[model samples]
Target: MTAIPLSWWVSVATALFVIGLYATLTRKNAIAVLIGLELMLNSANINFVAFNRYTTPNQVGGQIFAVFVIAIAAAEAAVALAIIIATYRRSATVDVEDIDSMKF
Candidate 1:
């Protein structure tokens, strides 16, 4: 098996992050936005793990931060999903444009 270069992994992570950012910026669906957020978070996690693996002496700070990020993302997903549900109940739709009237 051929060994993969660390730069390749880092580049892949950067691509994922950029794509996720684009998706988050252009998508109108709340679920799609959440997916983009997840992709971005995972990309960051990949970077952390890759750096931790490649750097000599095994500095674990990156890995620790990645784990913390994962946990925080999970909590964010739960809370955001709850808010989405509440919004859907009130608006009867999940389209971002449909809820623009904030007078309610």
Candidate 2:
């Protein structure tokens, strides 16, 4: 089996990051925003792992950082979901604009 070039993974990671940014900015629903955030985080993780694999010196920094990122992402997801669920229960809506009650 032929191994795919490192550039391909980098390109894919960049694409995922861009798409996630767009989605996060354009999305109105809370769930969609969360998904975009998760996508961005995963893309970063892909980049870290790819770099670790491609590094000639085999430094453990990238892999260690990737693991840290994954742990943080998991915690973020858990907390975010809890907040979303609580907000939805109180407001009955997940739309970002609909939840804003403070007036300027």
Candidate 3:
């Protein structure tokens, strides 16, 4: 069985990151931005695992780091969603352009 090449993993991660970046930048909705952020984080996780597997198969550092990233992403999503919800309640919309002020 042939192992997958590092370049392939890197290419996939890069593509994912670009798509996420585009989505984050182009989307005006808060939920869409959050989805993009999650995609970007997932791409990073892919890179971490891929590099770890290729550079040091025996060590688990990469996986550990990926786990931490996942944790952080989850926490960020929760908090961000809470904020979005509150903002929507006040402004009646999730459009980024409409939210010009943070004052409540």
Candidate 3, residues 1-104, lDDT tens digits: the string is 13788999899999999999999999999999999999999999999998898899899999999999999999999999998999999989998878988546
Better of 1 and 3 by TM-score: 3
lDDT of 1 by residue, 5-79 (tens): 888998999999999999898888887889999999999999988888788335788889899999999999999
Report the lDDT tens digits of candidate 2 across residue range 26-67.
999998999999999989999988878787335778889989
TM-scores for every candidate against the unseen true structure: 0.87, 0.88, 0.95
Candidates 2 and 3, the one with greater TM-score: 3
- Residue pair clashes in candidate 2: none
RMSD of each: 2.3, 2.0, 1.8
Task: Return the candidate ranking by lDDT, descending.
Answer: 3, 2, 1
Look at candidate 1 and tell me the lDDT of residue 86. 93
Off by over 4 Å in 3: none
Question: Which ten-residue region of model 1 has the weakest summed lDDT?
Answer: 50-59
Q: Give the candidate number with the greatest TM-score.
A: 3
Alpha-carbon shift of residue 69 in model 1 (angstroms): 0.7
Best candidate according to lDDT: 3
Ranking of candidates on TM-score, top first: 3, 2, 1
